[model samples]
Target: MRLALFQMTSGIDAASNGDAIAAAMDVAADGGADALLTPEMSLLLDRDRERAAVRAEADYPEIAVLRKNARELNLWLHLGLPVKQGDKRRNRTLVIAPNGEIAARYDKIHLFDVDLATGESWRESRVYEGGDAPVLVEMDEQEVGLSICYDIRFPALYRTLAEAGAGLLTIPAAFTVPTGRAHWHVLARARAIETGCFVAAPAQVGRHEDGRETFGHSVVIDPWGRTLLDMEQGRGVGFADIDFAAVARARVQVPALANARPIPSPVRRGMAAQAN
Candidate 1:
């Protein structure tokens, strides 16, 4: 399948963001893309809690447009992360089928709560509630697993998805500049190598309306951990051709997933005493 990953800067206006998304989807479809993927907070990116809450009400207009575009263009789409309306919002990703129906939804499982030496502090949990379960979907005979930004730090989740027959993993993010510089590429490559799954990461780049900056190097990696496409700070669509056969080849060569074993807990390993 041909996938187009969009790396764009989204701001506070949901309507404006939706317009941009529509334009991107149109371009992707014209480029012979079977599917189009976007970054986190595709609808709106803002740090002002009060404004965000007020702007992102329960009526998600952006998702509606996405579904319509998917059906009209007969193309699959992954709306990376949108704020779902609730008393407390949920950071959610939606997989839309060509028929404009939602195939799967995965809420972000890990909240980004960190304090950086650059004097940047983020408390995602303050506004968004984390999801409790992982999500996997089958698209055109390919099993795809879903995740968000902060979840990349947790390898077990990727392992579980791969074990469940996911050959492709999607991690859409709006990563901070510091963390992205320090760990983005390495972490993404590690996830692909460890799981033997194709990694497609569409990310946000540049400055947002809230005066927040994101590191944008959206990448697509093969199952063997080879870079297929990398959007390095460019603000546009990045395309990559996906081969299902490559996934099988990599898994067969390594066979790491099949040779898995159970390990003792920290307590059994005598690490519990160290904590005390």
Candidate 2:
């Protein structure tokens, strides 16, 4: 499958972000891409709770436009946005099929609550409710696993999806500059190598209207942990070809999934001697 990763610098305006995403979808379609993956908070990236809440409606107009465009273009889309559910909000990823239907919805399971030494602090949990389960959906005969930004730091989530027969993993993010510079590439490649699956990460780049800067290295990694495409620090679409056969080849070579075994509780040192 041909994939397009859109690196965006989304701002506080939902309408502007919507326009950018729509334009990128057109470019992806023209480039013959089967799917387009966009960064997290593709609609709006406002740190202000009051401003963000105003646009976080369940029936967002931007989403309707995106769905209609997806149907017209006959291309799949992986979009990340903040969604309102009753009195709560969720950082969500929606996998939209070519027929303008939602194939799968994955709320971001891992919320980013960090205080970096570089004086950058984020408390994602303050505004969003974490998702309880992982999501895997089928697209063009391929099973794709869905995850948001902070979920990349957790390996067990990726393993669960891989064990459940996911061949491609999509990680849409708006990573901070400090953390992105340190662990972005390594963690992404690690997840791909560990699961023997293709990893496509579309990220937000540059400074935003909300006064936050993001690291903008949108990357695609094969099962063999090779960087197929990297759009480093830019706001545009990057294309890559995904070969499922490579997944089979890598899994066969390593056999990590097959060889996985359940772990038992560790025995205490003194208790071990007594038991013996």
Candidate 3:
């Protein structure tokens, strides 16, 4: 499958971000991409809660426009956006098929709540509710796992998806520069290697209207931990060709998933006396 990853520098303006995403879809379609994956918060990235809520509430209109575009272009679009759910919002991904139907929706199960050494702090749980389950969907004859930015840190989720027959994983993110530089590539590659699944991480890059900087290396890693495409610091769409055969080969060569066995609870043992 041919995939296009959109590395965006989304800002406080919802309309502007929507326009950018729509334009990228056109580019991806014209380039003969089977699907376009966008970064997290592709619709609006704002630190201010009040402003963000107002802007995010208006997302349905933008989604309608995007759906129309998807239908017209006959392109599949996997978009990351903030969705208003009852009294709170959820960081969600919507996979729209070529026919403009919503094929799948996955809310982010992990929230980023950290106090960084760089004096940057984020409390994602403050405004968003966490999802309860992992989502796997069929697309282009392959099973795809859905996850968002902070979800990459949790290996259990990836393992569950992999065990559930997912051959491809999508990790769309808006990562802080500090964490991104330290763990982004390592975590992505680790998940791919562990699960024997192709990893596609479309990321948000550069300074935003909200005064935060993000690490911008949107990457795609093969099951063997090979970096297929890395759009380092550039803000646009990057393309990669995925071979499902690689997934099969990697799994067969490693056989870790097949060899996996449940571990029993640890039993405490008395410590032996140390020799003087």
Candidate 4:
């Protein structure tokens, strides 16, 4: 499947940001993309808690348009982290099929609460509630695992998805500049390698109108842990054609999933050794 990973800077204004996302989706469609992916906080990305929550309310205009547009254009759409209808906001991803039906939804499972060396402090949990369930969405002829920015840090999550029979994983993010630079590619590739699944991450880049900066290197990695496409650090849309055959090939050769060995606890091992 040919996919387009869109990179853009999102701001606090929901309407304007919606327009931008719509435009980007159109471009992806024009580029002959079968599926178009956008970044986390695709709606309103303001750090100011009250302001952001207020703006985040409602079925975001962009998602509604993208869903309609996806059905019209016959392109599969996967957008990240729109605030859903709830007293507590949930960072979420919505997958819209070609016919404009809501196929699957994945919430951002891991909250990014960190204090950076750059003196940037983020408390994602303050605004967005962490999701309890791991989302493995079904797309055209494939089982696609779903995650958001912070969830990629946890490898066990990817393993669960793979064990659940996901051939591909979608990780849409608006990772901070510091963290994104340090661990984005490495972790993304690691997940793909560990799971033997194709990983696609479309990210937010640069500073937004709200004065928040993001690290934008939208990447697509094959099951063999090779990067098929990287958007780098800027505003851009990276496109690539992914083949599920590669996933099968990688898993067959490595077969790490089957080779997993179970061992006793550390204390049990020590006792057994002493007894021996």
TM-score of each: 0.94, 0.96, 0.95, 0.92
Write candidate 2's Cα lDDT for 1-276 as tens digits: 999999999988788898999999999999999999999988888888877644454568888999999999999999888888667788888899999999899999988888888777788777778999999999999999999989999999999999999999999999988889999999999999999999999999999988999999999999999999999997799999999999999999998999999989986688777888
Candidate 3 structure, TM-score to reference: 0.95
Residue 68 C-alpha lDDT in model 3: 91
Error of 3 at 248 (Å): 0.7
Please provide the root mean square deviation of candidate 2 (C-alpha atoms, Å).
2.0
Winner by lDDT between candidate 3 and candidate 1: 3
* Clash-forming residue pairs, model 3: none
Worst ten in a row by lDDT for model 1: 53-62
Runs off by more than 4 Å, candidate 4: 53-58, 262-264, 268-276
lDDT of each: 0.89, 0.92, 0.92, 0.84
Ranking by lDDT: 2, 3, 1, 4
Worst 10 residues of 4 by lDDT: 53-62
* Runs off by more than 4 Å, candidate 1: 53-58, 266-276
Model 4: how far residue 13 lies from native, Å: 1.3
